[model samples]
Target chain A: MKSPFIAVSKSEFILYLREPSAFFFTLVFPLLMMLLFASMWGNDPFPGEEYGYVDFSVPAFMGLVMATSFIMSLTTSMAAYREKGVLKRFRAAPATPSSILIGQLSAVFAITVAGVILLLIAGIVFYDLRFLGNFFEFVFAFLLSAGSIAALGFIPASLAPTARSGVVIANIMYFPMLFLSGAALPWFMLPDLMKKISLVFPLTHAIKLMQGVWLGGHFWDYPVHLAVLTGFVFAGLFVSVRYFRWE
Target chain B: MTDNVVTVRNLVKHYKDVKAVDGISFSVKRGEIFGIVGPNGAGKTTTIDCIAGMHRAYSGSIDVLGLDPVSDSIALKRRIGLQQQESEIPDRLRLREAMELFSSFYKKALDWKMLLEQLNLWEKKDSFYSALSGGQKKRLFVAMALIGDPEIVFLDEFTSGLDPQARISIWKLVGNLRDQGRTVVLSTHYMDEAERLCDRVAIVDHGKLAALDSPSDLIAAHGGHTRVYFDASEGFDGKSLSLLEGVESFVNRGDACTLEVNARSAIVEIVKTLDVMGQGLDSFRIEAPTLEDVFLNITGRQVRD
Candidate 1:
């Protein structure tokens, strides 16, 4: 049997595709960061390695893109829709709230997938980056990371009273996650206490998992990172479902 | 088929310290345009919200088409269409896309092409929601509600922002819905709209059911007197006018004289009294009993805002 929620998902996807701001922030901005950083510090390598900042910055930039697209964009848009009575309008019909949430999450997931693919292509062509890990393991980690971040985004979306407040709440969590989770700055550079605090954020674990898979670390080596990201997916889903509001 | 499409008994709702709906009871028959009319804080919208299953945790029973609106919401939703007081589609969603997507939620939906044509929205099918005018957005909402071809339709503040022409067009469409055997439940504070369009009206005030009847019936029952007012002139006597058989009161405001008469047609009696007294009025007009007057008589206050 065909699930009716799929129709809503398709419609949401089309609407997202038509939004120019979404395209710029999700797809274009990440590649631009990679290019700009490569120009600034591409030649400087670590003490014993030939690879420069571009090699490390490219993967961190992927985490940044996921954080922006999945966490920031999804939370802001959903909360805005709720604030504008779009969710109430849907509730007036026969559509269920869970279906609407799934529809929105699927659209965000699809956009993240497309954005990551494009980023990977640019990484390989422009910076001569390669996937040292097994292709299937990288695929699994990438999808799990996106799912975790996307789910975590709904927490702020559900709690916010209005769209503007939703953006503010998301940014409150977003900037800290970006800087501390090795997206804007590497984890090794952070002080010991900051590193401990960063571990509490899902993005920190997500970036660790992504970097592990991208740089050939075996799946068995990062059990804690995998568990933490999976925990975010579960926790986010629980809170979002419990406090979901149609209006 | 049952005659009553909606039945609300002792319905009560509260918002923190405010009692928004206080034990209002009413029933709406199938194929009738039943109106819930009241002032801004009068709970008309709250009643509709309770009936539509948009509101929950109320104290009483609300049955719509033999289904409990809150518990059987999924089944109830498919059978009823709701045009909420404040609802908007996504800003970038085009008209046709919205219609198509909403129609998919129902088992029986009207043809989008025919619905668009009927609402005069065909020409603007490709327009984004943000680009449409206010009236057009309202029409689109109406179309989305009707697309389900549901047995009952609830429209809250349906014509609040519409121009006169658009309002009339919508009235015609509502009449068409009744002709097609669909029950309509409308909430509005407009007395003229209630008087003109409702088969029966429930006048709500201060979170209670003040009165419920046909517009004319309510007017005839509680609407006290027809007031005749004219400029206070030299020949008019307030004392004599107050002594007339059906005259309730005669107030002389220096600039104007208002004679409140019990009879519906007060002009003939007023002219007769004037002739007998050898008096003439300048610029006289009779104010007949309206739904507003009925509300005023029952609540002892004007419905403001």
Candidate 2:
């Protein structure tokens, strides 16, 4: 007999594949953005910079991918399940609340990894993207960044009363984060006022940590970014477990 | 040991200012199909929700299979199954996959493939949920509920939106569950369903249980009079027919006569008298008292939403 976690995760993974909007955003949308930016900015490295435009943007785009997959996709799916009474059915069964949460997180993380891998391949093949960072450090930074954002997803997932409202809340947060977090536009291009405000967004810290590690810098070199992301991880999970509703 | 599998004492639940369930009490015996029947918003679903532990009552005590529904919810959930009134599966989920997924959520489970076959859904195992018709979707939920081999099953508004043919098919599936010695608690607004399928019926109105008893007993006590109508011949005396035993009253309207009787034997006596009168009866029909009549009698004739 399969464990409930495994069963639920496998079911959720299949459901993720079946949702067209989630598939397009997580896997297809990021690559399209990468191509558009690489073509527009020309892959040549900037003055005194070791990497080209695509190389710098690839890690930042990964942050955007995490936001879409976790903040948008995961929240909407969980809210829709609650609205449809699917969660109620699961609760009536032997499946625990932890099992459902872990299953959803696992599925969203798997899709985020797939999206990131696709973006990386596009950059390395078409734009000659550089990878100067240590592989293990980069992996650690990626996991921490993605895990924190995915945990943060549960806040909207728990608070949204319906799937339609979940989409509204996600978009309200997503569009602002995309423009302010340096995930779409580079950090240096922003004015000092915008940069100061961007520090308040969790996605900003995620991109800072990811970009730092991808550019051959140690993760511990950015203590504040590390702490902020770690704090979000704990706070998000705490709020979700404390208040998540099954129906 | 007591045969009662479920017992509720003064179950009261409130939704803010409105009382959803007001001091309702009932016990369900083992291996019987018990029904909670009422109009829309009469708190039938709310009562089931309380017993299933889906919602906590404002003030009440409930015991299901020797466990409190609130404190021992997880254990009670494992021993019982629920089919909610408005729950749905993902449209993209295949029938076979859904059965398999739900099957893993229990310690002991029936063969899901066999359950599908029993529910007449084996041929559509690979079909997505969106592809099934309304009746088929209802049957699939029942199959999912039974996959865990629960000792008790709660089905809320089991056939609320089904066509007549579909309703009958679902009724047979429910009968099979009762035959397996599993206690079945169901709620429906269709009185005929309660009259035919339920061993005992609890009629609820305005969040209160108006009456609870076997269908026949309720019909006998509060179902009012059974009317026998026939086209009366010219020169027939309605007063003579009214004097017959068990006939409570006689009324003549246009060319027809109606005999209100308190017992089934009164119909035979009236028939014999009509034959002896040589009135040559034509076009006769009987309106027997049913659960609907009992409901109207107890709950008043006001229409409910």
* Highest DockQ against the true fold, candidate: 2
- After best superposition, candidate 2 residue A137: deviation in angstroms? 1.6
Best by lDDT: 2
Clashing pairs for model 1 are none
lDDT (C-alpha, whole model) for all candidates: 0.84, 0.88
Retained true contacts (fraction), each candidate: 0.67, 0.59
Residue A92 shift from truth in candidate 1, angstroms: 1.7
lDDT of 1 by residue, B191-242 (tens): 9898999999999998999889999899889987889987755655667668
Docking class of 1: medium
Model 2 chain A: lowest-lDDT 10 consecutive positions: A89-98
Per-residue lDDT tens digits of candidate 2, residues A23-122? Answer: 9998999889889988999778779988888888899999999999889988898889888888887877767677888888888888988999999899
Native-referenced Cα lDDT, model 2: 0.88
lDDT of 2 by residue, B213-248 (tens): 999999999989999999987766878789999999
Q: Local error of candidate 1 at B299, Å?
A: 0.9
Q: Provide the lDDT at B189 for model 1.
A: 86
Which TM-score value belongs to model 1?
A: 0.89
